[model samples]
Target: MNDVRLYSKTDFSKCQLTQHPLYSYIQTFLNHDISCLVENCRNATCYAIEFGKELILVVDAQFQAGQTYPTSLRAQYLDYAQEELALTEIKGQKLLSGAFRLLKTIVPQKIDEAVYVGNYLVSTNLFPNFTLEEVQAIELLLNKHFPNKTIVYRSQNSFLNQELMEHLDVLDYQPFISRQVFIAHQAQVIKRKKSFKKDCKLAKDTMFDIRIDFDVENYTERIIELYSQLYISKYSKINPLYTTVFIEAMTDAQNTQFIGIFDDEKLIGVTMSWSFDGVLTVPILGYDLSYPKEAGIYRLLTYFTLLRVNDEQIFHMSSGVGPFKLSRGAEYFPEYIYYKRVPSAKGYTCSFWLLQKLNKILIRISKKKVF
Candidate 1:
């Protein structure tokens, strides 16, 4: 077998995707089913590199040069918002969510505003760290495929070091922020703090049941209702289309698992998790907002989710809920988003500079205390 192959519906079914890393398997799946979500793209594909049955790197490629810029930006933003944002309150969250929807509707996604070329949605940073040779191979392929267009990458700090940046035209470090992750072996079971412990205890006394399989016939409507309601009120950025596709993907993926938390036979909360490469990731989670906060449904969900995780597997709790995840012994790591444009693309460079300034200003605003 070739060391590197870009699969664009080239008999991928024969290959064992499960043998690859988690992120790679997801990318391969998306490529195989790209028509379901995106359409009429030039070279949308998934790139994979393997050495003697072991996967080295996986890249999700979307060559949208001929496509309109706004559509690509909107799709990218939807993917980002779906993965990153979450909220515990309703009022403020709703306002922010509406504003983002309006912004996406009104603002034109122009070519000049494009920061990535054939973007890697989930960088190798999150999976098994790529070796130096493999990283060089990725750089070469990216350069060949997107010589004029700027290629952007978002990765955890460990992979965004000086050596990698030296090969790129420009590297932009996003505002310093940490994403929380749970390392099972590094984590020791601990009692929740006083208030949280009280809440968990209260929730335990109630008749709450946890179910681990996804039955579309029995759970689809309720799951959609809860997800839609929570996405609007709990996330600042909302993507209706992506949410639909995501729900479909979660239900269809063989390695995926669903955790349904029920209250007296009624579904009150749901979590979508994926198990791969000795790791478990909690990607989608939400509870019915109608439940009073005092009901402690969220606490109950977290408690049981952690209990099901084995000590040998890494639990990717995912981003958001910083204070809560930290309390549960999650280690913190900074994620870096890198941007680069060739010297000829002056328009993009100027746009990126302005964007960097805007990002800094927003960071300052976020740091200020609300009265």
Candidate 2:
């Protein structure tokens, strides 16, 4: 028989997660709180849900207006209008901005209440084998517990979680393409791609040394700094702002490896890879941007991490840098966010429906553009 067990912050000790593979990583959030990992989601509350043998993390948040992108429904769906509009190279930029401003006005309605299943605010949420019965059970439990909140499942793609997504779709959940992600199968990436071979050669011939074994304790601050330089400073600030505490806990977690790139004695690049089932994802990676582009610090880091993917493991390279990942034989797929509003959320029906329409339009627009 399939059953669902939910564990809140106060009752976390009652759950038996010691035998779970991700116990340590999950405990890190429970111990120091999730705000240390994702600063924008400080108001979010997390819970652990056990369905059969699978353990899933749930993040519930009441998103406020003007909240940053990561945890904000308005920012992701409505604010993204600016970027989506830019892709078409339309002539009237100010008009598009004005339209977006008008749309943002309805963002703070009842749509703010959301419950994200299997959301760690990471690049991908690796799912275990969830039967259809399990999905239905979990959905029922979430609907009962979260009442008027929108239940969401993020970071889903056809390549990795096709069956799971199909189950949700059949259950009447609306699918929205959140972003495009790259996944490299070990067989295809290692055997077929000539560019991958070249990347491997470049990685080996690079002046920087790749060190798999390092004292993470000594370099916790450095890791945060390097990661911030790329993810926060260069990329959008909406990305998770990981602190030293998160880094320290991740280093000590099981099935997780942190690789460091050294230029002589100075550590210049860092990448951390974690695996579950047969999937491996490098959620944390960064390098010193001061180095010339020719240095290939990022390339070296990617190559070394790709090497960790064994014969059966598929590497979830996550989103962005489509051309680079494509050259290395990574297949692109649209990652989706599947959501369903509870019956009590009828007041926000129009707002939710508008977001869904916008998401569909964005997906259609993105299909024409490469990446």
State each model's C-alpha RMSD to the native. 6.6, 2.2
For candidate 1, the lDDT comes to 0.49
lDDT at position 106, candidate 1: 46
Clashes of 2: 0
Relative to the true structure, candidate 1 reaches a TM of 0.67
- What candidate 2 gets wrong by more than 4 Å, as runs, is 65-70, 80-99, 188-191
Q: Name the runs in model 1 displaced over 4 angstroms.
A: 11-18, 21-125, 155-186, 189-196, 214-217, 237-249, 252-254, 308-311, 359-371
Q: Mind giving the per-residue lDDT tens digits that candidate 1 earns over 1-371?
A: 23544433454445565545443445544455543432333234444444444543333333344332212443433233323433233335555455446544443344223333223232123444344554445555656655654445544343223454343322332332223333432434434445446655765687778677846447766776776566544653322322344466557655677888888788999877666556566555678999898777777767666665555666666555656766765554444445544567544554444445534633343344111
Error of 1 at 239 (Å): 4.2
Residue 349, candidate 1: Cα error in Å is 1.3
Task: Give one digit per residue, the lDDT tens place, for model 2 in 33-145.
Answer: 77776665675778889876667788887866554454556666666546545544544556756766777786555676888888766767888877778888888888788
